[model samples]
Target: MGPTLATRLADWIDELGLTDHLAAAGLPSFTRDASGAPSWIEADGEPLSDERLAELDASLRDHGDDPAHGVPVALVLLARKARLRAELLATPAWTYDHLAEVRGASLNATRFWVHKQAEEHHLLTVAQGEHLLVPAFQLTPSGDVRPELLPVLEPLLAAGTDPWDAWIWLTQPAGLLGGDVPERLAADPEEAALVAHAATRLAQRVTASPKPRPRPAPSPVPPASGGCGCGGHH
Candidate 1:
């Protein structure tokens, strides 16, 4: 065998530059057991049991691998977790039930409103387990949706921009807005107009540009002759 699972996984983690990220997330660090097999130790020094390790290994295998890129498909899945979710997982957010209670509205009514608003791109909602989470940044202190934020959100939504990407862009500082975070900028009536204009321009630019496609998977070997399509005729 080439590299054992422990060794390969360690190298891949380093290659992906996720060591700090994993640690920040409280994930167990990978290591070799006494028998030189794969093991993990939690932050509290609790060892991951053998049975749990086997289950994790099985899950990783089931996630499959992309032979084309030599990447464990699971790793891609981990890294591609909607950018908003990755960055804002710990951000203050409210679930439908919580919003319903706060608004004194029925859960069904709240759900309907949230779904409609989110679908219209008037709200930022992130999928979390069995529920959708609305980050507090888009809401008033009274738990009501910030109507001012809606205009800024509309351009991105109307442009068919992915909600996750829009969420990240809105929350990040934008040079166009003099490094003001769009979400915060939208909180001010005077500044919000600027943010809306910036958002509209951004949406227009994204719409006018062609998205980059993934690089084609490399071929295993040289083609034989005669302009083979696959680049591998062996």
Candidate 2:
């Protein structure tokens, strides 16, 4: 099990060198007791201001999403949920008419594909208010749907993520893609295959349990040598 929010907060306080600031604010130090157990913060006579709580809340929210900072999975999931909600809200919604126009296809044809091929082909659409928005990134410059998209989309949809959420997963930088966003990298066939494979793994993870798996460990940094590792520096 990971540390509690209080423990994390206390750690952050020390990590950020905020001991003096907290003291000046008349707040007790968020530190461990001599026995290495958690010590709760207590106000020194004066009540803690709402401003201080708000600041600490925001700080906890940010660090709670980061594993390196010892944030628990629960807080991390909360942060992720907030971010997904925001992404869905900020994402632009396009009408069927607009979608058909962008694809250079008749409305009827577009509707057929959206209704019929969407599931099989991995086309994503989201309902916003009264209209369903089709994310524009799914298409190539040639106005045809990117053939490579379906493979990645299939597993994500099957994994129970909504279209918008699936799209977010595709567009975000994937470690499996060597830090390339899946949507952009889909143009290259070899990379697209890898992207699709990675998407399947993500699908498995999404479907495996209600609780989110732990976030992937951060990549290790290469040690710096005096000269460039390549002879080019010579």
Candidate 3:
């Protein structure tokens, strides 16, 4: 009922100033139908299908709404993809089999250890499909989880931080760690304890803070034109 796909595509084309670029590339210019919805022509003289406009809209959604200032759209897409790849590499998800292989433990024993770590110890575990995933960064290359992690996790969980949030806090850059993440600091026992202490203080502060009570809703205003909106002024 709003702008048709073709119409939206036409709007984006103009907003992005793609007309001249397309022309320079020897591509056909966008045209409109009698109803003002967009149509297209191929680089050749042949007419393009309306489906092409819809496809164009679908592809553009991946770039997100903001066009980075003075950056090419293709470069924006590349940067976005690079950022995603970096994040994925930084916090890899470890499955039971992977952990078992790395730790030299039997699969059953690994599963049992993971359960105890998650439940009794409050280490972070994410449920992904039928598998439970732990962040690989929490473990050392020799395949043991960092000793300093659990103490921090205990305070975080006690303060009502969920496992996922706890994981994020551990991995996020911190001022106390000179802009290094807690996970990286956790490589050193003393630094890891410092991270835990910071977590404890944070949790304590949150636990000590007073919760705000909900405010009551305002009553409807009475009209001054010889009537109340609620008909109470009659």
Best by lDDT: 1
Q: How far does residue 9 in candidate 3 sit from its true spot (Å)?
A: 18
TM-score per prediction, in order, is 0.57, 0.53, 0.48
Per-residue C-alpha lDDT of model 1 across residues 31-112, encoded as one tens digit per residue: 6558656456665666667665545445544643643235445455555554546677666778887887777899999899
- Local error of candidate 1 at residue 32 (angstroms): 9.8
Candidate 3: list runs displaced more than 4 Å: 1-90, 176-178, 205-234
Ten contiguous residues minimizing lDDT sum, candidate 2 = 225-234
Order of candidate numbers by lDDT, starting with the best? 1, 3, 2
| TM-score, predicted candidate 3 vs. hidden true structure | 0.48
Error of 2 at 47 (Å): 22
Off by over 4 Å in 2: 1-93, 211-234
TM-score of 2: 0.53
- Residues 1-234, candidate 2, lDDT per residue (tens digit)? 996655666666566545445544434455567865545554543333456644655644554455446443344454465567566556544567876777788998888777775666467776666776667777666445678787888888777765666777777877877899898887787678888898899889878868746545544556587756552000
Instruction: Tell me which of candidates 2 and 3 scores higher on TM-score.
Output: 2
Against the true structure, what is every candidate's RMSD? 13.5, 19.2, 15.7
Candidate 3 residue lDDT tens string, 126-184: 65457677777777786676776778777876786645556656777767667788867
Better of 2 and 3 by lDDT: 3
Weakest ten-residue segment in model 1 by summed lDDT? 63-72
